[model samples]
Target: MKFGGLQLLLAIALALAAGVLGAIAAGELRDTGQSQTLHHFVHEELDLTDRQKAQLNQLENNFAAERKDMEISLRAANSQLAAAMEDEHEYGPKVVSAIDEVHDRMGDLQKATVRHVFDMRALLDPQQQLRFDRQVASSLTSEPGE
Candidate 1:
């Protein structure tokens, strides 16, 4: 009975760890794909005037810095989560709090990325905006590698 209980607890812990890691991996993959799609659409698909290009360059630079900071914070949150899991060896208050922090960081990064996308879209002309909108919608809706 003791052994069975320990095995069950180990299984549950493994499941929780897998869930957390999977969520993080999926988020990172989606973020990378979205970034690549947008970068390609803006730089290659859309025809931008010199002024628009300059403006976009500046926006990209600023967003890059912000994105880096958010990513760093997210990494830190993940580290905390790992520590909590290791120290507690099971789901506990510390683990729950760390998970929440990770989710919050992910949400912050996602919101900032969406805002940056909108800011870029704003610089486009009507026709460009139409194309950009379609691309953005498609990127968001499509499955990974689709």
Candidate 2:
């Protein structure tokens, strides 16, 4: 099937934008305190009490260390995949292994993130829990770079 020039150009532009956004997000996540940001949002947006805020902060701090370790593993896995790609030997097996490692690390990170959110919500009252649920739903629908 033949493709139109504009369609192909549009596809390429979209792919480029996705790559740029991914890189920017990775840098921000690596250098910034995302765990702190999560607590800040819950404190400011959920009208949490001082004690609840402290509890949330403590929870986030605990999760932050684990999350950071998972991120390191993910980065190392990605580096291994890149090395495998650039190696003189056949890349198929090495690349597959690295990708699987990345997936496992990512799964751990995602589990921690969800657990963090749940633990934070548990500290809130019923009203706050409802509001927090709505907040999470809206946040999920937010645009990139939010």
For candidate 1, list the clashing residue pairs, or say none.
none
Give me the overall lDDT of model 2: 0.64
How does each model score on TM-score? 0.79, 0.69
Residue 69 in model 2: lDDT: 79
Q: Per-residue lDDT for 1-146 in model 2, tens only?
A: 34567655554454344334334433334324233344556877777788987887788789878777777776666666555544423337875786577667666667777877898889999998898887777655655445
Judged by TM-score, which candidate is best?
1
True-structure RMSD, every candidate: 4.8, 8.5
Q: Report the lDDT tens digits of candidate 1 across residue range 1-146.
A: 23366655665565456456635543454554344667878988898999999999999999999988988887788778767766676679988998898878878887888899999999999999999999989877887757
Off by over 4 Å in 2: 1-38, 88-91
Worst window of 10 by summed lDDT in candidate 1 = 25-34
- State how far residue 18 of model 2 sits from its true place (Å): 12
Clash count per candidate: 0, 0
Of the candidates shown, which would achieve the greatest lDDT relative to the real structure?
1
